[model samples]
Target: MRCDRIEDLLPAYADSALDPRERAEVEVHLASCPACTSLLACLRAADEALAVFPEVDPGTELRGRLVSIAAPRQKFSLFTLLRKPSLQPVLTAASVLGVVASLYLLNPGRRDFEKNVVRTFHRGVGRVEKLYAQAGGITGSIGSFAENLYASLRSSNPLERDKD
Candidate 1:
Protein backbone atom coordinates (compact mmCIF):
# COMPACT_ATOMS: atom_id res chain seq x y z
CA MET A 1 0.00 0.00 0.00
CA ARG A 2 0.98 3.63 -0.49
CA CYS A 3 2.59 5.48 2.43
CA ASP A 4 -0.42 7.85 2.70
CA ARG A 5 -2.93 4.94 2.73
CA ILE A 6 -0.86 3.15 5.35
CA GLU A 7 -0.79 6.31 7.50
CA ASP A 8 -4.60 6.57 7.21
CA LEU A 9 -4.92 2.99 8.48
CA LEU A 10 -2.30 3.45 11.21
CA PRO A 11 -4.77 4.54 13.92
CA ALA A 12 -7.12 1.62 13.14
CA TYR A 13 -4.09 -0.72 13.03
CA ALA A 14 -3.01 0.51 16.48
CA ASP A 15 -6.53 -0.09 17.78
CA SER A 16 -6.56 -3.60 16.24
CA ALA A 17 -9.67 -2.79 14.22
CA LEU A 18 -8.06 -3.49 10.81
CA ASP A 19 -8.70 -6.65 8.74
CA PRO A 20 -5.80 -9.12 8.17
CA ARG A 21 -5.22 -7.83 4.64
CA GLU A 22 -5.19 -4.17 5.81
CA ARG A 23 -2.80 -5.09 8.66
CA ALA A 24 -0.46 -6.81 6.19
CA GLU A 25 -0.50 -3.77 3.89
CA VAL A 26 0.29 -1.45 6.84
CA GLU A 27 3.13 -3.77 7.95
CA VAL A 28 4.62 -3.80 4.46
CA HIS A 29 4.50 0.02 4.29
CA LEU A 30 5.99 0.34 7.80
CA ALA A 31 8.94 -1.92 6.83
CA SER A 32 9.60 0.05 3.59
CA CYS A 33 9.03 3.54 5.06
CA PRO A 34 11.41 4.34 7.95
CA ALA A 35 9.54 7.54 8.70
CA CYS A 36 6.16 5.70 9.07
CA THR A 37 7.88 3.04 11.26
CA SER A 38 9.11 5.71 13.63
CA LEU A 39 5.66 7.38 13.64
CA LEU A 40 3.98 4.08 14.55
CA ALA A 41 6.47 3.58 17.37
CA CYS A 42 5.68 7.00 18.77
CA LEU A 43 1.88 6.33 18.49
CA ARG A 44 2.34 3.01 20.37
CA ALA A 45 4.38 4.72 23.05
CA ALA A 46 1.65 7.40 23.46
CA ASP A 47 -1.07 4.72 23.66
CA GLU A 48 0.92 2.83 26.34
CA ALA A 49 1.45 6.01 28.31
CA LEU A 50 -2.28 6.76 28.18
CA ALA A 51 -3.14 3.22 29.25
CA VAL A 52 -0.71 3.29 32.17
CA PHE A 53 -3.08 5.40 34.28
CA PRO A 54 -5.04 3.54 37.02
CA GLU A 55 -8.85 3.38 37.08
CA VAL A 56 -10.59 5.93 39.30
CA ASP A 57 -12.32 4.65 42.47
CA PRO A 58 -15.12 6.42 44.28
CA GLY A 59 -14.15 6.70 48.01
CA THR A 60 -16.62 6.04 50.86
CA GLU A 61 -17.40 9.75 51.17
CA LEU A 62 -18.07 10.06 47.44
CA ARG A 63 -20.26 6.92 47.46
CA GLY A 64 -22.17 8.28 50.48
CA ARG A 65 -22.75 11.57 48.68
CA LEU A 66 -24.02 9.78 45.57
CA VAL A 67 -26.26 7.51 47.66
CA SER A 68 -27.72 10.51 49.47
CA ILE A 69 -28.46 12.20 46.13
CA ALA A 70 -30.14 9.04 44.77
CA ALA A 71 -31.94 7.82 47.92
CA PRO A 72 -34.74 10.38 47.83
CA ARG A 73 -35.65 9.38 44.26
CA GLN A 74 -35.43 5.63 44.75
CA LYS A 75 -38.78 5.34 46.54
CA PHE A 76 -40.69 7.14 43.76
CA SER A 77 -44.11 5.52 43.40
CA LEU A 78 -45.47 5.31 39.87
CA PHE A 79 -48.81 6.79 40.94
CA THR A 80 -47.24 9.74 42.79
CA LEU A 81 -48.38 12.76 40.82
CA LEU A 82 -46.42 15.14 43.08
CA ARG A 83 -42.94 13.79 42.38
CA LYS A 84 -42.88 13.99 38.58
CA PRO A 85 -41.03 16.81 36.81
CA SER A 86 -43.36 16.34 33.84
CA LEU A 87 -46.47 16.90 36.00
CA GLN A 88 -45.59 20.41 37.22
CA PRO A 89 -46.70 22.10 34.02
CA VAL A 90 -49.89 20.08 33.99
CA LEU A 91 -50.57 20.93 37.63
CA THR A 92 -49.98 24.62 37.02
CA ALA A 93 -52.26 24.61 33.99
CA ALA A 94 -54.95 22.80 35.96
CA SER A 95 -54.72 25.34 38.77
CA VAL A 96 -55.12 28.20 36.33
CA LEU A 97 -58.10 26.50 34.73
CA GLY A 98 -59.65 25.90 38.14
CA VAL A 99 -59.25 29.56 39.11
CA VAL A 100 -60.81 30.70 35.86
CA ALA A 101 -63.66 28.25 36.28
CA SER A 102 -64.29 29.42 39.85
CA LEU A 103 -64.36 33.07 38.75
CA TYR A 104 -66.73 32.22 35.96
CA LEU A 105 -69.02 30.28 38.27
CA LEU A 106 -69.02 33.02 40.91
CA ASN A 107 -70.23 35.65 38.50
CA PRO A 108 -72.11 33.67 35.89
CA GLY A 109 -74.81 36.32 35.50
CA ARG A 110 -72.60 39.43 35.50
CA ARG A 111 -72.87 40.08 31.76
CA ASP A 112 -76.62 39.51 31.79
CA PHE A 113 -76.89 41.83 34.76
CA GLU A 114 -75.09 44.67 32.94
CA LYS A 115 -77.23 44.14 29.86
CA ASN A 116 -80.39 44.17 31.96
CA VAL A 117 -79.35 47.42 33.71
CA VAL A 118 -78.64 49.12 30.38
CA ARG A 119 -81.96 47.96 28.92
CA THR A 120 -83.89 49.17 31.97
CA PHE A 121 -82.18 52.58 31.77
CA HIS A 122 -83.11 52.91 28.13
CA ARG A 123 -86.73 51.97 28.86
CA GLY A 124 -86.88 54.53 31.69
CA VAL A 125 -85.55 57.28 29.37
CA GLY A 126 -88.17 56.47 26.76
CA ARG A 127 -90.98 56.66 29.34
CA VAL A 128 -89.62 59.96 30.66
CA GLU A 129 -89.52 61.40 27.14
CA LYS A 130 -93.11 60.37 26.55
CA LEU A 131 -94.21 61.96 29.85
CA TYR A 132 -92.31 65.17 28.98
CA ALA A 133 -94.03 65.44 25.61
CA GLN A 134 -97.42 64.90 27.25
CA ALA A 135 -96.64 67.51 29.86
CA GLY A 136 -95.64 70.02 27.16
CA GLY A 137 -98.96 69.44 25.35
CA ILE A 138 -100.91 69.91 28.61
CA THR A 139 -99.06 73.17 29.36
CA GLY A 140 -99.76 74.51 25.91
CA SER A 141 -103.49 73.75 26.22
CA ILE A 142 -103.72 75.45 29.66
CA GLY A 143 -101.94 78.55 28.36
CA SER A 144 -104.33 78.78 25.40
CA PHE A 145 -107.34 78.54 27.75
CA ALA A 146 -105.99 81.32 30.04
CA GLU A 147 -105.31 83.66 27.10
CA ASN A 148 -108.84 83.13 25.74
CA LEU A 149 -110.40 83.74 29.17
CA TYR A 150 -108.49 86.97 29.64
CA ALA A 151 -109.26 88.18 26.15
CA SER A 152 -113.00 87.54 26.67
CA LEU A 153 -112.97 89.34 30.04
CA ARG A 154 -111.12 92.37 28.67
CA SER A 155 -113.00 92.75 25.34
CA SER A 156 -116.54 91.56 24.95
CA ASN A 157 -117.31 92.85 21.51
CA PRO A 158 -119.38 90.32 19.61
CA LEU A 159 -117.59 90.83 16.34
CA GLU A 160 -114.14 90.51 18.02
CA ARG A 161 -115.17 87.35 19.85
CA ASP A 162 -116.47 85.88 16.61
CA LYS A 163 -113.26 86.81 14.86
CA ASP A 164 -111.18 85.17 17.60
Candidate 2:
Protein backbone atom coordinates (compact mmCIF):
# COMPACT_ATOMS: atom_id res chain seq x y z
CA MET A 1 0.00 0.00 0.00
CA ARG A 2 1.10 3.63 -0.62
CA CYS A 3 2.25 5.73 2.40
CA ASP A 4 -0.73 8.13 2.09
CA ARG A 5 -3.26 5.26 1.90
CA ILE A 6 -1.56 3.61 4.89
CA GLU A 7 -1.68 6.96 6.78
CA ASP A 8 -5.45 7.29 6.08
CA LEU A 9 -6.11 3.74 7.19
CA LEU A 10 -4.01 4.21 10.39
CA PRO A 11 -6.87 5.95 12.31
CA ALA A 12 -9.34 3.19 11.38
CA TYR A 13 -6.62 0.58 12.13
CA ALA A 14 -6.14 2.07 15.61
CA ASP A 15 -9.93 1.95 16.07
CA SER A 16 -9.92 -1.75 14.94
CA ALA A 17 -12.58 -0.90 12.30
CA LEU A 18 -10.59 -2.44 9.37
CA ASP A 19 -10.87 -6.04 8.10
CA PRO A 20 -8.00 -8.46 8.94
CA ARG A 21 -6.53 -8.33 5.35
CA GLU A 22 -6.52 -4.46 5.23
CA ARG A 23 -5.12 -4.27 8.78
CA ALA A 24 -2.29 -6.66 7.84
CA GLU A 25 -1.45 -4.48 4.76
CA VAL A 26 -1.38 -1.28 6.88
CA GLU A 27 0.76 -3.02 9.55
CA VAL A 28 3.31 -4.02 6.87
CA HIS A 29 3.46 -0.42 5.57
CA LEU A 30 3.69 1.01 9.10
CA ALA A 31 6.62 -1.37 9.88
CA SER A 32 8.50 -0.05 6.77
CA CYS A 33 7.54 3.69 7.17
CA PRO A 34 8.84 5.61 10.24
CA ALA A 35 6.65 8.72 9.48
CA CYS A 36 3.44 6.63 9.40
CA THR A 37 4.51 4.76 12.58
CA SER A 38 5.03 8.13 14.35
CA LEU A 39 1.58 9.32 13.12
CA LEU A 40 -0.05 6.13 14.44
CA ALA A 41 1.73 6.66 17.80
CA CYS A 42 0.38 10.28 18.02
CA LEU A 43 -3.16 9.04 17.11
CA ARG A 44 -2.99 6.39 19.85
CA ALA A 45 -1.73 8.93 22.42
CA ALA A 46 -4.61 11.36 21.55
CA ASP A 47 -7.11 8.50 21.73
CA GLU A 48 -5.75 7.47 25.17
CA ALA A 49 -5.90 11.13 26.41
CA LEU A 50 -9.52 11.41 25.25
CA ALA A 51 -10.43 8.10 26.88
CA VAL A 52 -9.05 9.29 30.26
CA PHE A 53 -11.72 12.03 30.49
CA PRO A 54 -14.63 10.73 32.60
CA GLU A 55 -18.12 10.92 31.04
CA VAL A 56 -20.44 13.19 33.00
CA ASP A 57 -24.25 12.80 32.79
CA PRO A 58 -26.14 16.07 32.99
CA GLY A 59 -28.89 16.38 35.67
CA THR A 60 -32.50 15.74 34.53
CA GLU A 61 -33.35 19.47 34.68
CA LEU A 62 -30.26 20.43 32.65
CA ARG A 63 -30.95 17.68 30.09
CA GLY A 64 -34.56 18.91 29.75
CA ARG A 65 -33.41 22.53 29.26
CA LEU A 66 -30.83 21.46 26.66
CA VAL A 67 -33.43 19.45 24.75
CA SER A 68 -35.87 22.37 24.82
CA ILE A 69 -33.21 24.78 23.53
CA ALA A 70 -32.12 22.41 20.75
CA ALA A 71 -35.64 21.50 19.55
CA PRO A 72 -37.16 23.60 16.73
CA ARG A 73 -40.47 25.31 17.57
CA GLN A 74 -43.25 24.89 14.98
CA LYS A 75 -45.15 27.98 13.85
CA PHE A 76 -47.71 28.86 11.17
CA SER A 77 -46.16 30.87 8.31
CA LEU A 78 -46.23 31.25 4.51
CA PHE A 79 -42.41 30.83 4.47
CA THR A 80 -42.92 27.32 5.88
CA LEU A 81 -44.45 26.39 2.49
CA LEU A 82 -40.89 25.62 1.34
CA ARG A 83 -40.16 23.32 4.32
CA LYS A 84 -42.37 20.53 2.92
CA PRO A 85 -40.23 18.06 0.88
CA SER A 86 -43.05 17.05 -1.51
CA LEU A 87 -44.13 20.61 -2.36
CA GLN A 88 -40.64 21.80 -3.38
CA PRO A 89 -41.18 21.12 -7.11
CA VAL A 90 -44.70 22.62 -7.01
CA LEU A 91 -43.45 25.80 -5.29
CA THR A 92 -40.52 26.12 -7.69
CA ALA A 93 -42.81 25.74 -10.74
CA ALA A 94 -45.29 28.28 -9.35
CA SER A 95 -42.47 30.80 -8.69
CA VAL A 96 -41.05 30.42 -12.21
CA LEU A 97 -44.51 30.69 -13.86
CA GLY A 98 -45.38 33.78 -11.80
CA VAL A 99 -42.13 35.56 -12.77
CA VAL A 100 -42.57 34.65 -16.46
CA ALA A 101 -46.24 35.77 -16.51
CA SER A 102 -45.38 39.05 -14.78
CA LEU A 103 -42.50 39.72 -17.18
CA TYR A 104 -44.69 39.04 -20.26
CA LEU A 105 -47.52 41.29 -18.98
CA LEU A 106 -45.22 44.10 -17.76
CA ASN A 107 -42.76 44.28 -20.68
CA PRO A 108 -42.80 47.82 -22.16
CA GLY A 109 -41.66 46.71 -25.65
CA ARG A 110 -44.39 44.05 -26.09
CA ARG A 111 -46.72 44.89 -29.02
CA ASP A 112 -49.01 41.83 -28.97
CA PHE A 113 -51.65 43.67 -26.87
CA GLU A 114 -51.56 46.58 -29.32
CA LYS A 115 -52.08 44.13 -32.20
CA ASN A 116 -55.09 42.63 -30.39
CA VAL A 117 -56.58 46.13 -29.86
CA VAL A 118 -56.09 46.96 -33.56
CA ARG A 119 -57.71 43.64 -34.56
CA THR A 120 -60.71 44.40 -32.31
CA PHE A 121 -61.06 47.90 -33.86
CA HIS A 122 -61.00 46.44 -37.38
CA ARG A 123 -63.64 43.83 -36.45
CA GLY A 124 -65.87 46.61 -35.04
CA VAL A 125 -65.52 48.55 -38.30
CA GLY A 126 -66.46 45.45 -40.32
CA ARG A 127 -69.56 44.88 -38.18
CA VAL A 128 -70.61 48.54 -38.67
CA GLU A 129 -70.13 48.15 -42.44
CA LYS A 130 -72.46 45.11 -42.44
CA LEU A 131 -75.05 47.09 -40.43
CA TYR A 132 -74.84 50.01 -42.84
CA ALA A 133 -75.22 47.70 -45.87
CA GLN A 134 -78.24 45.93 -44.30
CA ALA A 135 -79.96 49.30 -43.58
CA GLY A 136 -79.36 50.37 -47.20
CA GLY A 137 -80.35 53.97 -48.15
CA ILE A 138 -83.17 53.95 -45.55
CA THR A 139 -80.66 54.44 -42.68
CA GLY A 140 -78.17 56.73 -44.46
CA SER A 141 -78.40 59.33 -41.66
CA ILE A 142 -77.99 56.65 -38.96
CA GLY A 143 -75.09 55.08 -40.92
CA SER A 144 -73.30 58.44 -41.10
CA PHE A 145 -73.94 58.94 -37.37
CA ALA A 146 -72.60 55.45 -36.61
CA GLU A 147 -69.57 56.11 -38.80
CA ASN A 148 -68.87 59.35 -36.91
CA LEU A 149 -69.19 57.54 -33.54
CA TYR A 150 -66.75 54.84 -34.66
CA ALA A 151 -64.21 57.46 -35.86
CA SER A 152 -64.51 59.36 -32.55
CA LEU A 153 -63.99 56.16 -30.48
CA ARG A 154 -60.90 55.20 -32.55
CA SER A 155 -59.40 58.67 -32.26
CA SER A 156 -59.98 58.86 -28.48
CA ASN A 157 -58.30 55.49 -27.79
CA PRO A 158 -55.13 56.00 -25.65
CA LEU A 159 -53.11 53.44 -27.67
CA GLU A 160 -53.97 55.22 -31.00
CA ARG A 161 -53.13 58.60 -29.43
CA ASP A 162 -49.80 57.24 -28.17
CA LYS A 163 -48.92 56.13 -31.71
CA ASP A 164 -49.38 59.71 -32.97
Best by lDDT: 2
RMSD (Å) of each candidate, 1 decimal: 14.3, 22.3
- Write the residue-wise lDDT of candidate 1 on 1-164 in tens digits: 77788878888999999999889888888878998998888989999998897888879999999889877565557677576798999989999999988887789797897799999999999999999999999999999999999887758777777776
In candidate 2, position 95 carries an lDDT of: 96
True lDDT of residue 110, candidate 2: 70
Task: Tell me the spans in candidate 1 whose CA falls farther than 4 Å from its real position.
Answer: 15-21, 72-164
lDDT of 1: 0.88
What overall lDDT goes with each candidate model? 0.88, 0.90
Best by TM-score: 1
lDDT of 1 at 31: 79
Clashing pairs in 2: none
Measure candidate 2: CA RMSD: 22.3
